[model samples]
Target: MLLKQMTAAALAAALSLFLSGSVTAAAEEHYDVYHYDCWSEAVPSQAGYTAERAVSGQDLGVGNFSEPTDIFRDSHDRFYIVDSGNDRIVVTDAELETVEKVFDTFTMPDGSETALNSPQGVYVAPETELLYIADYDNSRVLISDYDGNVQREITKPDSELFSQELTFLPQKVLADKAGNVYIVLGNITTGAAMFSSDGVFQGYYGANTVQTTPEVIVNHFRKLLSTDEMRSRQARTVPSGITNFDLDDEGFIYTCSQSTSQTQDTVKKLNAAGANLFSSLGVTWGDIRSYYDTNTNTNYQPMICDIEISDDKSINCLDLTTGRVFQYDKEGSLLFIFGSKSDQLGGFTEVTALESCGESIYVVDKRKNTVTVFAETDFGSLVHKATELYNAGYYEEALAPWYQVLQYDGNYVRAYEGIASGLLVKGDYEGSMRYAKLADSNSRYNKAFEGYRQEWLSAHFTQVAIVVILVAAVLTGLHFYRKKHIAKTETAERSEQP
Candidate 1:
């Protein structure tokens, strides 16, 4: 019995050691290097964006944040954190280390005061130094200055166009270069509510388009055949509401709709006339496939919560589902995807907003009540430089940076495309075709093939013409020889018969 007990103890100890070794190996293999392929499938690649550090209220000496909703970086590089639950806006310096200013209440010109109530969005005009706040619970917008002096208070419109039965609960606000205010109302499917510089109610702008399917066509036909009473009972077709939007330096508005059902026009770049400038461009906004989580055994579809436009025309979109920030170029090519849904420093819970300040990106997590800062990696820098030149129509000049990107991440489809485009512009059609094929870019490959065919035909034109002429001459000589031989044979046969 004693000998058997000793052997069993030894076996148990060996099994324990093996289990610990397996756990250590799993930990070592885990890495945060997620990327999207040509088909928008999330795959592992070199790290593009990493969470450098996280800044909470503790880091900034603000005690603790409670439900921080939005983050914005203005032209002066100032950081604004909308502390909604605290009913105040926290301002930090360019480094985000020291507190610059805090606004809790607004003093009106009439010697009255108004305090913020669960403010959700904040925007500061660069030229005029004006601040716009979307006071959510109050159902109004407050136009103020840096010192919290109220310039005007814009409430719900009393217009014939607006439905009186509905409520105006503004969620996000922004100002254009001309001082026009655009406010996004909750549950408003028509578009963003636009206002004039003087606080007059303007019409809506940049409404989302309704996606049409076969069912929608059938419904429309049925509606046409139904009576007015039946038509009233039928379900009305409406567009998905716009979730968030950002303004570029060029006065263009970039908008995103977070509806999973409405896949078309999920992201759009609108011109002044509310025309989608990127409609003709073949690009999808977010991940093309549903993200599957092994731990939860569930599939998640990304809902874009906010959008931030960088000075170099990079589109940074915040995903609420997986806490990932998907960065795209001006032409809608995915540059890098970073962040995750974890309790770790780089991960997030309830990501609400995003702001881009120069080389860094700040994301606000409402549930965690913290702001996570992400700095660009070396791979990210190379990709951004290549994208800048490529978007500017300098394909040949972008070749070096794109090649450097490939050195870091050979599987980067965009880099392959960039190199292909550069080769095409340099008149190296065959070389361009090879890169285009590698990138799986059919349109680019077709262009390269057409150029190659044209060049080959031009080069061998003389040889082809000589061959055609010689062939034609030989055929004519053969025809005449056969005719002459037949005539002689016929004459000889006739003479012999006589």
Candidate 2:
């Protein structure tokens, strides 16, 4: 009895560590791919930063591996990677010492072998201990326990849906505390498919407002389906279909279904109750993400192939199509972006995945069949640290950090801004002006913000300062005058009355 209880406690502790996201991607070093069995003669350099190879072979004990689609760390510090090519979810011990197969029993749909079909994204939600997946090709969202047991499938209905094809070719899947899962697509939303944690389909929200024509992607919302219109159709076609999507965490569902009078990219942030609290551009149509290099201070335009939100809330965008990584802030502001055009060690040429584990960052180069790790110390030597220094009001100290990253990447953007801004703050107007002009000269269009920052400061600092002073003065005058008047009025009224 004592032995059995001890074993159970140990198992529970391990599981907890595997589910925590903070420690999930922990690693001291990284792997650089030298070979892969999937694609012949593939080189890690071809994948750029997306190609951070994982541990080779089944050496870590997870048993023979297959084409790993996505890698995630659980709270127990165990690594769970979906080996889609092998039709299995692989796991690694807390120490990453032994790789083992945790879930050998995944539910195969009515007539399938094994379980998953072209599974894309794999995420283990600690709040619910549920593993959510974008079961691509199946047109469904498959749910499972952390051990890879398929518990349920979430799919949209057909008969009453707007699109002739109610296909859910889910590309990415994410889950929040409310048991709501977010699914991105290889195509557009038929309606943002909603489901409870138990796999009960709540209903669909957000129409497929996106229409891909032979011409440019339609930015017009009126041409697409709207929520109100869906209501009218739902009552006729199907009683449960919806048109408005309110993502609790993302804030609002910027459905591009409104009339054309105002339709850029419908950006809306919604609350848990589905109330639209904020609305702005969510994602753009036909928009490809680009990365501006802080080193060369040049911008590289690439098709956004993959994107992930880091633990720090920074959006890690990858243009594996062009071999680049674009980092954007939560506010949609572009920060320093970096990637290699070279096929060399320490530098990437292609990317399969870009993951940020709390202590370090990892990039998987599928072509090379290896993972390259970047420690925080390694990151501290990069332009990002300098940007941090600049952001923390330590402008002068940021110069060295930014300069080091420039040695490796010449096109990084924030580095230029750091140098330029730091100079401005230090009262080096000439240096600041030089950097601003140089920044503008590089892209031939002032794509860098250093010039803009300097110009804006030079343009409005005095006006803003004067406004603050005037407002302060007026408030002070009003306070004093009101007090004096009240006192005098009381004296006059008393004397007259008496």
Off by over 4 Å in 1: 1-43, 221-234, 292-299, 446-462, 477-498
lDDT of 2 by residue, 103-199 (tens): 5446554645345676766667766777777677677777877555566777654434335464667756666677777665555434455566665
How far out, in Å, is residue 211 in model 2? 8.6
Candidate 1, 73-161: lDDT as tens digits: 88899999999999989999988899898888899889888899999999999989898999999999999989888998889999987
Highest lDDT among the candidates is held by which one?
1
Looking at model 1, the pairs that clash are: none
lDDT of each: 0.87, 0.53
By TM-score, how accurate is candidate 2? 0.53
Candidate 2 worst ten-residue window by lDDT: 237-246
Error of 1 at 148 (Å): 1.4
Error of 2 at 464 (Å): 25
TM-score of each prediction: 0.86, 0.53
Error at 228, model 2, angstroms: 25
